[model samples]
Target chain A: MSELRTAGANPPWDGLDGSDRHAACMVAARDGDRTALDVLVTELTPLVWHVARGNGLDRSTAEDVVQTVWLALLRHLDRLVEPRALVGWLVTTTRREAQRSWRTNRGQVPLSVELTEQLPTEDWLPEDEALRDDRDRRLWTAFSRLNHRCQEILRLTVLAGRAEYRAVAEALSMPRGSIGPTRGRCLSQLRELLNAEGGSR
Target chain B: MNDIDPRDDDRGHEDAAVLTDLGRLVHELDPPPVGLVERIQFAIALEHLDVEVARWERAGSFAGVRGDRPGTITFTVDNLTVMVNFTSTGERHRIDGWLVPAGQHTVEVRVADHNSTTTRADDGGRFVLSDVPAGTTQILVHLVNSQGEPGRTVVTPTIML
Candidate 1:
């Protein structure tokens, strides 16, 4: 089955970017629409998990951190200043929680630098049984060869889907205008790495 | 709102193809674990949500736990803290927990909104919640004031038992 949901078919709400999606959901949620909240959680959990995992947390730990972020969001919903900033809010919050989990795992009492900390290298998407195909494995290896910033930018762009550059900027402190350039550079670098490795047709 | 124009990105079709491939590969590598949506659904059903969030700590857990292992976790909010012990009881879980500093409070183990069970912590802060369905559950510790109005409420991170 093709996994391209909302790819060519622009639904009435499909044109909305990441934050806009969250904003629309938030509106429904504030009106006591329980289903809307479920939509928000189901759609956004992948993004939150990616943010936490990209910080180099192991699978279980990343799951725990993402759970914490959702719980915290529940407690702070009314206090949210900008409902439209939900993607940015989730990104920033998930990162901080991931960092806290990272620190606690290392027995640190205080959280380190917010944005620039290097997490202990972890097998995030460890070789899973589902990825036994040779080409998929090679693609994983090739993708891993990119620097941290490139990997993050690519994943963030995918999560943001049609590019809410502002939400992307909030997730990783990049200049909004530079996201396109960075994405281009990173994709080229990934392509070169794959070619040099002679893997992935 | 600044929107993205793939056309304005000035990218060759090859780059777009690569992004598509990468997205498919990553999604296949590790999709969000099943039951994640159900778990979040249970987590957000706070009747009174303006309560303090008790950040969680994996105080203790058994390694390689699968079928019938006991596990414990701790969550803290302000000076208040709660620790829950889970013993797998077939398809359900028996939850025994305690409050820090030993105070009298009401502890509620709620699965969804209707299947809620409440217990009172004793003077020594011990409480037991039984027969909770082995699914996503949120535990709330509420201290009520003189007029029976809730004063301080501490909640655990949504936990899968």
Candidate 2:
């Protein structure tokens, strides 16, 4: 068990950083500035995609989910109060849309297979020399083995590292207080899994 | 062995190694294929064009006849329900409708053309166009309506096409 150093309680995510971009986007979008909306969409598409995929939505469905989320954004633009909350709002909306899309379409056919089957096989190859030499395959394998929640939380918070704990907590439905502890625990779990699989060469 | 603190050992070595690897992997993972900004930008431009078209339709009439414009329109355009309180005239127009389909069309106003100034409607009846051009030009419109119907409208620009 690794000792958690409170995972940097401040997290340097203080006031508004990425959320500022979202605010700018909202203002632009509100003034009927499609360019700002385009910028917003371009920057956040990956985040939404990852969110959809992390939520167990298959690729095609996830794509639909992303599209739906954007459409919803257009509808909700006037109702939004804070510009900074866009990230959290989007993530939460995407999750809800993805789940809804999955549930709605799951009965017709399994589209998740399409996305997972289309998974980038090349990622299996460790690109970094340090990670490549000894424990690359094991680490990669362990990553795939991580449960959906862990994968999503890790990717959104640690990988993207764009949103704050409040946003992350709202998006993931975890307790606001538990975000730091859970993040630490999730990282610890990953390390443990890696170590058990002969990590660090 | 009794004095050996496992916590310190784990923190000093294992955690650092894992954190480093996690950081590397996170940065290294390729992002999924995204539509180019240019493509989105194009779509947005089309959307703006739609908004401008909408602006003309309600109270922003170009030739005293509102909602009468035509061009290679986008059928998949979204957010068309715009409520504009025109400062130019102190009037408001709430124009909400689906994208019009392709064909010869007419607009009481003009839509600016800034890109190729021409595009073909997709099978789904959406076209990418630049700003509407100037002068008494005949606008060709092939667009789909909100109900996804193939339709056409032809308009001579009274404002700025």
Candidate 3:
């Protein structure tokens, strides 16, 4: 922990990077540093957003889930045993909250129809309109081609960055060892799709 | 066969580059809703860290035929239930709120990027905040324990007004 903290007098709190930074920020936040808490919220919100979106939640619902997860963190700040595991804790909480919201939205559907509804559909994402550039459109088109698991894994791993593989793996319930290979295969498959489209064009 | 595949190293490097590019593209395409972080920060900016956040019960929007009626929403946690009705008058808005187990309490309406309005609920558990600027808002009910000390605060999720 001392190593994670900055050295020398008047050292800025922003010295650490990656998970170490998160842990340091968490420690500072617990010690009543509002600035550290703000940094944590700004830095981690995107990862939390992707986690919620990856769970197939609509925009509004995902937004609510993201807020709820952060509120939960604020409430449980002292109870979090390992500040270093903050990403994993947040990812897992987001998934749970997203699933809860998803269930609430689908509560009216009959049990028999619910299973079918659970299957990934080809509905247009709200973000589709934002993909204006031809390159972005093409990449999204290929991204949409992958299976639900592949899409989820790729989206989360990429958004969380390479340093957060352990957190992503644990949150997704996938073996830690499999994330790298699976991500590799998924990227390769995406490239193949992109190449095929390029050829056709 | 050797445990190491020569292509593995190169593929890993290539995958890293592609993933990085894809991450950028993904962000460009599907960024979180604008101001979401700031809104969350504003909502959680509580003076007391130990507080109870009321669960969102239900919200209903009623568009008046002539655009006159008010929209109502409610939140609950444990024994406390807070219900607020929103009515628009010109550009500003009015929030009339009621708390269950009716009693006197401090009611604060927190508006994002704006100074929060704090008012006291009457003995009947009624409070009103008038001329509120339109933006994201949240309600906080400050409770007093039987001993008349500062009890746990109950906060509602961010609501659009």
Q: What are the TM-scores, per candidate, against the unseen true structure?
A: 0.79, 0.51, 0.75
**Chain A structural similarity (TM-score) per candidate?**
0.70, 0.70, 0.73
What docking class should model 2 receive? incorrect
- B8-115 in candidate 3: lDDT tens per residue? 446666566556667788777778989888888887888877777775643222221123456677677789999888888766689898998887889988888788
Model 2, runs deviating above 4 Å: A1-17, A108-131, A160-175, B1-20, B34-161
DockQ-based class of model 3 = acceptable
For residue B68, give model 3's deviation from the true position in Å: 12
Top model by DockQ, which number?
Answer: 1
Interface RMSD of each candidate, angstroms, one decimal: 3.5, 14.2, 5.5
Tell me the whole-model lDDT of each prediction, alpha carbons only: 0.68, 0.47, 0.69
Q: TM-score of candidate 2 restricted to chain B? A: 0.22
Interface RMSD of 1: 3.5
Pairs with backbone N, CA or C atoms under 3 Å apart (clashes), candidate 1: none
Whose TM-score is greatest here?
A: 1
lDDT by residue (tens digit), candidate 2, B38-117: 33233233332322112122122122222334322211223332111111212222221123433322222223333224
